[model samples]
Target: MPSAHRERRRVTWWVALPAALALMAVVLGLLLLVAWLRLLPDALDPFGTRTEDRTGPALLESIQDMSRYEAASGNFQVVVDLDKDAKFLPDAVRGSRTLFVGAGTVGAHVDLGGLGEDAVTVTEDRKSATVTLPRARLGRAALDADRSYAVAKERGLLDRLGDVFSDNPNDEREVHRLAVRHIEEAARESDLTDRAERNTRTMLENLIRSLGYERITVRFAPPSG
Candidate 1:
């Protein structure tokens, strides 16, 4: 009788101990979850607001500031020809010209010199507009166009090689090697036209920014031919 009683007591304690521990663990987990939920708003607000809420207003202010600067300087001739295709425009013009300003400073400086008349072309519909800007008009912004161009040229070479040997990984590597060889050959063959173009583009962008036109828009014309 005594032994059986002791065994029964041990069994009860074992079962009770595990059950209590499990209950306590569950309670602790719930409390932690509640605390996290309460703190989430305060902790996440800054990052969330910076990425989603502040972007639009910030961009608008930048555009406005740039526009004001341009207006005050009164030194630019913004020519937007609505009779050309957008496809032929230079990459720089397509990318940088989209920035719209209403009244404040820009986060990044723009290099507008790469903008060219040759880049202006008509769209398929002929109803849109295209722009042709002079190199002098782009030099007013803060970014260094020459450096950008050099970087672009280097990346462009790699990108071209990637396009050529996209099917086979081994072929891709070989193509890259061949491309490098060709680039070296070309550089040895001439007076570094790539570098010259970069420098020229940078100078043009700086000149444009120096002038008072903050923003330039070119709507493309529909293509007739």
Candidate 2:
């Protein structure tokens, strides 16, 4: 009888210990969850749930404008008229420049009207030459405003945390910002002559396609007369 009682007590303790541990773990988890909720009350509303509908119209307009000018969805064009007396040659091309715009996911293209078909003719003085570019071969750029906003939002939160926690935001935001900054910097770093060239090319290609221009020609003139 005594041995049986001891065995039963041992078994009860083994079961009770696990149950108690489990209960403690569950309680801790709940507390952590509550704490997290307190920190980011809007976390459950991830898709801008609290955003006001009043801004809908404005947002749409902004989106439209961005899509047209900064985004890659609309047409972009620019024209650079050179002096008639200017002589542009192959060597003069070194100092030529172009402009670019960021439109949308597809990016910005170059302006075709700025470069005429006869612009590429090399002159005897090697002073200047016209270069015509087709719109189809232009490059496009991608932009992610939402990603950038998320990063800025996350960074704002970290700043409020008083330097105790690491200020790491979502990876998407970082990537988006890096890409935007890189393109902007590139535009600034490139020579003035070529600065607008990439953008112009992209724009011309998009415009030609949309306008049904099977063959589009642009002309460039010498800057110095």
Candidate 3:
């Protein structure tokens, strides 16, 4: 009986050490887990958030605020019809598009501030003067939102579906851009620059005549290349 009791005691003593060591391991593991959790970032998931910087919008705003002095303005209207088809598929239209009727104004200008000391010539008596002005050039084109509008629009199934997952330019800004482009082209082709030069000549002639000068010569400088 005493031998049986001693054998049981020995078995219990052996089991007790392993159980205590396992409990210590478990506690240490819990502490390590708490320390690891503290090292994680505050914003883990990027869902439903914008990660891009805001430099683009700010740049567009700066562009819109700039202006230049314009001498003559030409008003024009054009129909902007565009169609985009899938690049790999048949020629049938199947993509996003920007279509509109656009009305805008283009201006021509001459930088009078660039005139040199020889641009104006005066007689010794200050009775009459001859002035030469700089050549006229095209200015920034502007779109009138009140007169510009979308005529029609058709989007492909794929493009419409992709709108939900991506960022794309809408019709308004692109339409205005198209209008400005065409207006600038037309202004370059038209006689707006000549008209600007003529207008400047007439204005200077009148101003000199009003200053008691009987003869005033106002000429535009030859166009620069």
Candidate 4:
């Protein structure tokens, strides 16, 4: 009986006792990890996801859906000075002259929204492509109010007297308009349209080349009314 009890004690010390202690340690570690994670306020994703697969058809549709493609634009700067003389009486009697100077900018652009289905053509072997685009044109000019300012202005005695009793405001708005008009006129006379056409051609050629075409031909159709 004594020998049997000794053998049982040895087995517990070497195998069963160590196994039970290891199992308890594993459970304790798991419990501590759970508690630590619960202390954090936000849940965290272990795996980072950033990109997705993009298909060719989806990309093509997006390009076709564009309503306007600005091939090129020019920012034309100008300074303008204007004056107007006013009088309540005959020519030299108590007349007022307004001399004002202002500066501003305008833009010239091209339109490509008129491209039709027949505009693009690809060869049978897909080695070459021809793209027809509309001629470049100027769009509505925009004024950069932040960049524009009145350089100088002066109102004569008659004008100041008229303003004291009249509800009419100063002619600053009109002066600004004239400055913008001058910029537009100057841009019209420049080679902005020609530059836009050349840029458009280069852009189409590069785009077609990116699509695996060895040779690309770009042409501009006659302008439409």
> Which candidate number has the best lDDT?
3
What candidate 3 gets wrong by more than 4 Å, as runs, is 1-69, 90-93, 170-172
Query: lDDT of all the models against the reference?
Result: 0.38, 0.44, 0.77, 0.69
The candidate 4 region of ten consecutive residues with least summed lDDT is: 40-49
Stretches of candidate 1 off by over 4 Å are: 39-225
| Predicted candidate 2 versus true structure: per-residue lDDT over 1-225, tens digit per residue | 999999999999998999999999998787677665665366642322455566544343343222122213332221222121124433233222222222223333433445445645445654433346533222434554432232122222323363356544443444444555555454444443343454555665566546444444444333433
Global lDDT of model 3: 0.77
Question: For residues 1-225, could you state the per-residue lDDT of candidate 4 as single tens digits?
Answer: 999999999987888877889999998787667656664233342222347678656344344555555656667666666655553554343443444444444434456676678989998999989988777777755777777776665656665677789856446667667766777787788788788888878877888899899999998888666
Candidate 4 residues lying further than 4 Å off, grouped into runs, are 1-66, 87-103
Ranking by lDDT: 3, 4, 2, 1
Error in Å for residue 40 of model 4: 53
Ranking by TM-score: 3, 4, 2, 1
| Poorly placed runs, candidate 2 (over 4 Å) | 1-52, 59-108, 120-131, 134-142, 146-158, 161-179, 183-225
Worst 10 residues of 2 by lDDT: 76-85
Candidate 2 lDDT at 217 equals 46
Best by TM-score: 3
Q: Per-residue lDDT of 1-225 in model 1, one digit per residue for the tens?
A: 999999999999998998999999998787667665665465543322333555544344343324211211111111111121246555333311211111111121222434456665545654343454321121222222232111112223333465467743443334333333443343334433333334444554455445543443333234235
- Per-residue error at 212 for model 4, in Å? 0.7
